[model samples]
Target: MKIKNIILLLCFITGFNTAFANEGWINILNEGGNNKGILCTPAIQKAIEKASKNGGGTIFFPAGNYLTGPITLKSNITIYLDAGSVLKFSENFDDYLPYVEMRYEGIMMKTFSPLLYAKDAENISIKGRGVIDGQGKAWWNEVYRIESAKGPIPETKYQKMWTEQNKGIVYSPYYQRTIDKKFFRPAFFQAQNCKNILIEGVTFQNSPFWTINPVFCENINITGITIFNPHSPNTDGINPSSCKNVHISNCHISVGDDCITIKSGRDEDGRKYGIPTENVTITNCTMLSGHGGVVIGSEMSGGIKKITISNCVFDGTDRGIRIKSARGRGGVVEDIRVDNVVMKNIKEEAFMMNLFYDKNTVEEPVSERTPIFRNIHISNVTGTNVNKAGTVLGISEMPVQNISFSNINIQATEGFTLNTTDNVEFHDAKITTTLGSSFKIENSNNLILDNVASMKPIANTALIKLTDVSNMMISNNFPMFATDVFIEANGAKTKGIFLKNNVFNNVKKVINKGAALNAGAVVE
Candidate 1:
């Protein structure tokens, strides 16, 4: 069909965008932007350098408003954004001045340049129904004046004088603030060390930072996207650091932090780039007010394993399926799998696995920097109203191990907390708290609470509360029609607790040995 590709397919059938080259579509108004709302960044970087010099293609941005700046991308590229397009960007932070090799939140620095940047390119894509706006309210007001500045705060004019300047600026892994150019707010679509990747049906908005970041990428596929950065600080919605095969589906995030975060790099350059955000698969997503609706790591030092979160749906989120790490982040989050989720109005911990996220009280000695959470498996979950019905906080030098929770249900206001854990299990779980202990175990050991139940037991606590727990098994039960201590054994190293075949009418005291338990420590 070469008559100059049939007169550019009749100038795209008379709608006029003469850059149609067969197997590799392209328009940018036929490159060398002559119009269409100004700065089209040299006509979309000359149609991605003329389709990477004619070996790769698909660069169309048909319908309207585009004001661009930093856009690199290469190798087998694709950028189709049709339906009324609106690629807006450019709040002009010096148009992302010459800086490349990025990584930001997981260290590996070299600022700016990330309003759709790509590096170490490979097969890439960015399909669309179109609207990508990273206007991020004046770049989050320069991070709120570099976090309400205090002392020594020089360097502005967008830094860069061969940047190497600093006055401070750590900003929470617990403190220090006021430095510029190192970890600058850019990233509204980033890709590094790229591999086969794709982003589909877009709608991304307000960004300036963490709005679809994929560093050290591998085979990845994101689908039916729709992210809206509310409030804006940190604006995270789809972060994949040190990546591996990832497949996120049908998303509809609401961000301003964690509506999909899974990093594998942070401390000691993340164990010196040990590369680990492993095989992930998040499905049918729908999260609303961010800050954990699928979060992993308070920067997991290069180790987050086989992940899979399924049939998701969280609303008014503030934590749901969160796994955080700490203690110098030595890294080793293992086989995780959450399933059929559905949370609502959760304002905090509706399922959490923590490893002491740094208050760093200093009680050293666990080598390699210590940070290890193990074999996680959640199932048919449901949380409602929640304020806490979650927690497996480990760290008495490293404990969070083998965790399990099947057919779970939570309706919280405080309940479900296990500390410094070990092999934990809670099948057919049910927590419907309104106050205290609906399940609380501390300095844990092996435990199994099959058919675990609790409906609103807080009348003088104890629907299961054991401290310094030892190997325990509290079988099938339904407590809380009246339940007033259906098992309460405290400290004294709570020896081998047991209570087989449970169903104490409505339990009024099926075993209570508190006051530093002894007397063979709880068995009935």
Candidate 2:
């Protein structure tokens, strides 16, 4: 105990601020850090292996509590956590030993070793303002009793060699109950095939699962981070699977599932790891009570491109900008861009694109596993107290094409629903609903409603409600005053309904052909 009397006896018992006693800094209390909290993972893995064998620098963790387990970060490392540090992670499920090769929630094998791990490393970093505690409620109650099969299914040979290397390449009965719960937990920081990664200003809390999980990484930067797992079931916050040039900014997430999620793996092992979670950027973030404040894919099979979400803010999030996949997850979510978002209290759908996310109904024939939500663009978005002011579902043999919504505003209680979507375009949109029809088309086709509007029209519906829709164009709108009908043509494969130069204010009727329309379907 002579590293200056163990830093003057743990700095007079844990006030520990010897101002980082300068020396090319590798001080985890001179590689012994035991202010009596005992199990100091070999003095913080020997101060990150003595700063990766004296080539890299700063493995410092100044003020207190470093109860550890698995902390491995090699190449050119930096894991500095100074201000009243608390890197406590050890819920003790065999101290995360003997199962390594990571990638959970999108399936690759061998688990339990990600309490800050790194693989194929390159200039890695995990920066300051310390907290990083994953005392995750007994690993979410033994993975909720092995995913509700009610406990005890552990038959180890490393769960029979990880069920013969992740069985038949993930087809899902929830991936055989996560290999019979033998891979119950792991991930509260994972960096695989890493390169130039940086996680700045940390806080990260109780997460036995996903909280800053990076896989197949490249140039990554997560800034001003603060994640708090609200309930910790799946606890996802910043999950960048199959990463590419990524950047998430000014963060503050409240998680228990999806507060920033994007994937590119799963299904035929993510199309045999074709590698694509492309050039991403999520800017100015703040989302609370997560379940999706920017979620893409229900495991998109190796394809998710050019994503850019801007100026974000969501409160009490349950859904705000979600793009989910299905039909065996054969991915291609093209050039997505959601800008200037502001959502409030949204507990359902404040803009969501669903390719039938689950309940895989037998509809095969459109090859490559058929899941594609095309060239997305949602701009200047705003939602308030939303329950549902958005739902674009496609899957009548792969539809959901070219989605576009510009300067949109929503106040929901149900409105803005499309089905079997196609070239969707709505510029300067406003959906203020109290119930139905503020644009609720079905079996859609090239839908374009420019300068659209609706001001709480839930009277007798019809502010636009077509069915079996076809190439529709409701030109330059924005003339409201309640409504009884402003176009409501139904089924029988509704024809190219056109309403040019619209300005019909106090509407009582403006076309409501319900009897399976024919004669010029709907024209005003």
TM-score of 1: 0.39
Residue pairs with clashing backbones, model 1: none
Worst 10 residues of 2 by lDDT: 14-23
What is candidate 2's CA lDDT for residue 140?
Answer: 93
TM-score of each: 0.39, 0.40
Error of 1 at 144 (Å): 44
Give the lDDT of residue 417 in candidate 1.
89
